[model samples]
Target: MLIFLDYFLLFFHIALTAFNALGWAFERTRKAHLILILLTLASWTVLSPYFGWGYCPFTDWHWQVKRALGEGPLPGSFIKYCLDGCTGWDSDPVTVTYYTAVIGVVVFLLSCGVNWRAWRKSHHTQSSEIA
Candidate 1:
């Protein structure tokens, strides 16, 4: 069960990370993307005081499972873990964190811009019709 959960979380977290990065590109997912990205940022920043910076609940849960399975010490960054696992390159955690942060901020801003434009366009259309 724990092994299954570990694999499930690995897949789910990767899928979620991909979505958080690219979901805004699709019109149907823009709002959800914005919300998710904001929530991610909040987790990293707003929840940092208690959980420490760059905290992710999913990662925490996964790490717990890993510890239960007797895995050795893990990197602080999940992105680094994925990269190292997938590419066989031991990435620097600080560098991974920096890139992760920059990418997150970029995606968040892009999501906001696209969502705002969509909302404004719809609002304008409604106003024009009402007028």
Candidate 2:
């Protein structure tokens, strides 16, 4: 189970990261495309728990296994925090707030950089024409 989760996360992250990265690679994304990227990030974060997410969801899933099998770090006779959502850790609200913020800023910056370059070129052309 843990191995499977890890594989899933890796594949999803790589694909989505590449999707957004390449979209911004050639040029700055238009307002609509930028919004779509933001939405994708938000969707990943908000549905992370249900979808299994983060830089290492597999690690977390393994932790649960160790706890159940009576391993270290968990420090308990039994029970695990691995499946928080299913095991009643839902009260704490498993929100991916941090990643959402990080991704949002990153996406926004890329958008700004692209727009800035385009604007600068336009301005230079206009100035040259006037001269």
Candidate 3:
């Protein structure tokens, strides 16, 4: 149940980021676009690795969360269990990285879409005045 909940939250957060980025892209300057690009990368790292749930059986920070909730530290064996889920010896690191890159790319493309929409709208308004 906890596992399901954790992944659910992770997906939802990513979705929200995509949505917010789209909205902001509408009115951002070039600098803002750069900032958004960097942020999307940062989020990918955090959400996909030790800090996030990207490739581990348990998220890298799951132990911390469990500890903070008065559950105490997870047993070493349990930690291994979670890590195994995310990165088993049989798992291909290349594959994992590919998935991570894909996520980042998807967000980046969405940002571009927002910017294009805004651009087109502005272009339309300007052209209408010449007609």
Where does the lowest 10-residue lDDT sum fall in candidate 2? 74-83
Q: Which pairs clash (backbone N, Cα, C closer than 3 Å) in model 3?
A: 48-54, 55-86, 56-86, 57-86
Give me the displacement of residue 130 in model 3, in angstroms: 7.0
The 10 consecutive residues of candidate 3 with the worst lDDT sum are 74-83
lDDT of each: 0.95, 0.53, 0.53
Model 3 alpha-carbon drift over 4 Å, by segment: 1-38, 43-63, 67-94
Positional deviation of residue 14's Cα in model 2 after best superposition, in angstroms: 11
Residue 34, candidate 3: how far off, in angstroms?
A: 10
Q: List residue ranges in candidate 2 displaced over 4 A.
A: 1-22, 28-32, 35-95
RMSD of 2: 10.3
Per-residue lDDT over 1-131 for candidate 3, one digit per residue giving the tens place of the 0 to 100 score: 55655556456544544453454445545346646566656655655555443333333355545555565444332324333556754444456456556755765776676667877888999999889
All candidates: CA RMSD in angstroms? 0.6, 10.3, 8.5
Candidate 3 to truth, TM: 0.39
Q: Candidates' TM-scores?
A: 0.98, 0.37, 0.39
Name the top lDDT candidate: 1
Instruction: List, residue by residue over 1-131, the lDDT tens digit for candidate 1.
Output: 99999999999999999999999999999999999999999999999999988999999999999999999699877899999999999898988999999999999999999999999999999999999
Considering every candidate listed, which one attains the maximal TM-score?
1
